[model samples]
Target: MHILLVEDDHKAARLLARGLEEEGFAVTVAHTAAEASSHAHAMWRFDMAILDWMLPAKDGVALCAEWRQAQHQLPVLMLTARDAVADRIVGLNTGADDYLTKPFAFDELLARIRALLRRAVRAQHGILQVADLTLDPATRAVNRAGERLDLTPKEYAILELLMRHTGAVVTRQQLAEHVWHADLIAIDNLMDVHLKNLRRKVDPAGLPTLITTVRGRGFLLAQPEGGDA
Candidate 1:
């Protein structure tokens, strides 16, 4: 898993990054909120983030709030010296999934990280159904009308995004960012090819098409007329 570690303490950040790397995780260290924000918004996808409450300027709580406001689903774990219940409540209220006080044991920190990751996995794995189509996020399985459909990784990612926003138009930019982790212009043709293939497989002969193209806007995955998604 990839983790973004935001800590202003140079020595502490290094040690934590080293330990996490040793534990087989890709770690990106940011010494300030600005740097952390850049990393978070970058192409590199991180599974989780560990943020220090105390920073040079903008604090971790504010950063976490910003991320939440922007609809970034990356899990955040806050680290701080404040051990009071009020402080913990404030952190959690501001979008921190969990909070760890300063001088915490390394082993405990690792355990907490593992727990948060597990919770995230479970949340992501909830079965998604849009009309006859069903997606199992855990197994990466896609089925329509009880028939299994083989899909490329990119195709599956695109379909998942569409299914999640069923009935609502999902822009090409959103698909490109989520599936390819790149700008739409960079992969416009590539996205078209994948979408075509996906439509061919999912909308086979005799089956009501679920995918729709909203001209000049994007794509929408929805059920047929008189049916709800």
Candidate 2:
């Protein structure tokens, strides 16, 4: 899963990002609300957001409100020093799905994150499917044509991303940011390598490409009515 972490403290941001990455999550850190907004505007789609209530400008509450207003329904976890009931209420009211106070145990934070993710998956039926390709995020399982497919972590991540958007053409930049968490322009060829491996596993006997390149744009997972050629 890819997460957007908006924290003003550089130390805290790095520590949280490192821990999240170690837990098998791709994290993008932003020190301010403006920086967070910039990242959101990019092609990547974050599964969740961790925002600090206190920020240099446009605090977390405002940012959360903005996201809700824009209909960005991703779950948000608000982190702050304020632990009062009133504060928690305000955070939730402003569209935060969860709230955590500072000085809390890292384990607890991680647990809360997992819980929120579980809730999201449940809401979406716990499985993402396109055509005959199926991915169960909870089980980390993939099946194509009723046959189980063993996929590398990278392959799974890329396929999960494409499957989430289904027929929509997912940009190379989006794949790099969410799957590889790297700069797309510098690692274009690397992205290609992963995609090639993914295609081999997904459509080994390739005639009708399940994942199709959009020429200069990017790639799209074929939809039920077949995909745009």
Candidate 3:
């Protein structure tokens, strides 16, 4: 998964990046709020964001608010030195999915990241579909136009997010949020490559496209009536 880290501590940022990389996650580091803002705006889609409370210009809470204002639904985990109940409440209220205080065990941080991903992956509402595409959360099966579609973990997650929303628009940021677990790898054209691969696997020629781009908006997968083209 791709991650965007908004921490100013150089040593800590590099250290965390190394460890997370070992865990098979792609991570990107942002030292300040301005960097994070610019990075995210540049279509460097992140699955998750790790934000530090203290930054040069704006605090993590303010940056979190800014991301939300931009409709970035990616789960953000706030890492801060403050360890007060009120501070934790404020962090959560500010759109942080979880909080990790300084001097934290990296293991706990990793566990929290996994927990957040588990929450995102589940289908409390069960099956989701769009047109000929169908995803059975219980079976982990996907099918389209009477033909089954094979997907990797990341592809399945992407498709699941789209099917869950069906005809509703899902932006790249939203997709990143729903699919990204912990680390976001910078310098990788991961999302672009994956989307292209998914399209190829799911749609061959002459098939009324199931996954269609909404231009500047995002993407939508509409459920066709009775699987009709």
Candidate 4:
């Protein structure tokens, strides 16, 4: 649901971003390769990236190459003016997952985005159900032992994200990007509030806290004290 748009044409980029935003996507636009490079170097998290093949400093391919070198397996979608089979093949073989030519429809663009996101997500994209726990992405549902656990949308989102990245320490920024809306992004107590709420919901019995709050870093999902249930 988040994307990085690397296009030199500000107008075109704005229009594309607007369309994607309307469809409930968080978009960050980088008008120059330098800007994209800065973001990439800063470790800005994006579920997917859309790059213009024709760019200054470094073309899309070059930028993508750099990203791949640093952090491979990033889902990149390339946009170009050329429409040759060779060009598309080169783009894909380089690092891009999908390619869209100039004058492409917004619908197709959205579809491609979804497709790339889907492919990148693989087995880790959708709802997660383990034992009595039920985490549903679409409905934002969470249940334990067939008992429905009431959680606000934000709480549910955070819990689902934690489950998806179970056993790993998910930084606060990562949770912010995925669970919080743009308006709430500036809220200082965003993570603390939602996570405290989620803990109550998931650990009412004091059975064992699966959402472990790692001091100073972020959080992890597993039984409390690293003990087996």
Candidate 5:
């Protein structure tokens, strides 16, 4: 998922952005509200926004209100040092879906973000199952035939995307754009290498290959019969 992170403190923003990226989110960092507004104006597709209440020009509350006024439905999580009930209420009134105070634990922030994403994805966030393979997006868990699978962040992202579009061919461009940000160009065979590694981990010994390559087109996730996938 792509995230818009608005934080004014350089140190704090750097730490938080690194943490989010390590957790498998594509994050765009903006140190000021104007930068955040520019990103929004560019029509960047973001799954969620993490905004700091304190800013140079426009505060997070105002930015969130502006987003609401602009009919942007992206979930917003407000971060502030103000932990008072009234302050939180004001933040919520400004259209923030969740709140996290300063000095908060990274784990808690991760949980809140995941919760908001799940809420936004209503039907899309649940446990996805296909041919004895199961994936729980909420917990980032994947299991096949009751056996747990340990997958890297990139592998997990690719698997989840394919699972989301079961039986459909997911183009290389699509995968590249989502997995690696638009600014980063996907090198030749990068996708193939990751998919190959994912296939090896997901389809164990004596199991049918679940990922099907369509030569020059893309990949499809389906149970193939009596043939190599």
Candidate 6:
């Protein structure tokens, strides 16, 4: 999973990021709210955020509130030294999904993160469809025109993301971050190859092409005009 970790303590942030990375998470550390905001609004999509309650200008509570106000559903776990009951309530009320007090155990943090992710997945559970293409997140299955399409892991990830945002453009940067967990510049050629292969299979002969490339923007998956199957 991709995580945006916002903490002002440089040493603490580095240690936490290293630990999360060791646990197989892609971590982006931000030392300030501005940096965190930039990363949050960038083309990269973060699955969750670990925010320190006491940040330099804008605190984590305020930042979390801002994200909620903007309709961003990114799960937030607030870390703070305040152990008061009222403080915890305030953090939750400010839009944090979970709270971790300072000097926390790494294992506990990891467990909470897993639990939050599980809840998120359950919330999004359902069959996804765009035009004639269908994908079952539970089964990792894909089908079109009554026939199942065999797909590689990478191809399936790309398609799932596109299907989830049907009718909207998904930028290459977003795809790379979510799928490959790498920068777009490093995986540009590799991405093109996978995209081409995916298109060939998903858009075969005698069927309307569902995936289209918007030059200088990204890829779009949508039903053709007239909505023919």
The prediction achieving the highest TM-score against the true structure is 2
When 1 and 6 are scored with TM-score, the better candidate is 6
Encode model 4's per-residue lDDT on 1-229: one tens digit a residue. 6788999999999999999999988888999889988876434357789999999878998888888888756689999998999999989888888899988988899889988877766635576864457786655568876778988867876777778777789888777766653544485486787788788888777465577778888888864564544
Ranking by lDDT: 6, 1, 2, 5, 3, 4
**Segments in model 3 whose C-alpha atoms lie over 4 Å from true places:** 42-44, 123-128, 136-140, 145-148, 153-229
Residue-level lDDT of model 6, residues 190-225, one tens digit each, is: 999999999999999999899999999999999988
What tens digits encode model 1's per-residue C-alpha lDDT throughout 1-229?
6688999999999999999989977787899999988865552367799999998889999999999998888889999999999999999999999999999999999999999988886888499988789998777889999999999988988898898788899999888766775678999999999999999999999988899899999999998887773
lDDT of 2 by residue, 1-229 (tens): 8889999999999999999999988888899999988865652468899999999969999999998898888999999999999999999999999999998899999999999998887777578877677899888899887889899998999998898887799999888877777889888998889899989888868445588999999999976454433
Output the number of the lDDT-best candidate.
Answer: 6
Off by over 4 Å in 1: 1-31, 34-48, 65-74, 79-95, 99-115
With a 3 Å backbone cut-off (N, CA, C), the pairs that clash in candidate 5 are none
- TM-score attained by model 4: 0.80
- Compute each candidate's TM-score over C-alphas: 0.67, 0.87, 0.68, 0.80, 0.63, 0.85
Q: Rank the candidates by TM-score, best first.
A: 2, 6, 4, 3, 1, 5
Report lDDT per candidate: 0.89, 0.87, 0.80, 0.79, 0.86, 0.90
lDDT of 3 at 32: 90
In candidate 2, stretches whose alpha carbon ends up further than 4 angstroms from where it belongs are 206-208, 223-229
Give lDDT for model 1.
0.89
- In the predicted model 1, the residue pairs found to clash are none
Report the lDDT tens digits of candidate 5 across residue range 1-229. Answer: 8999999999999998999989988888999988998876543357889999999988999989999999888899999999999999999998999999988999999999998988877745578888879899777889987889999998998898899888899888778766766632544478778888899988878887788888888889976575433
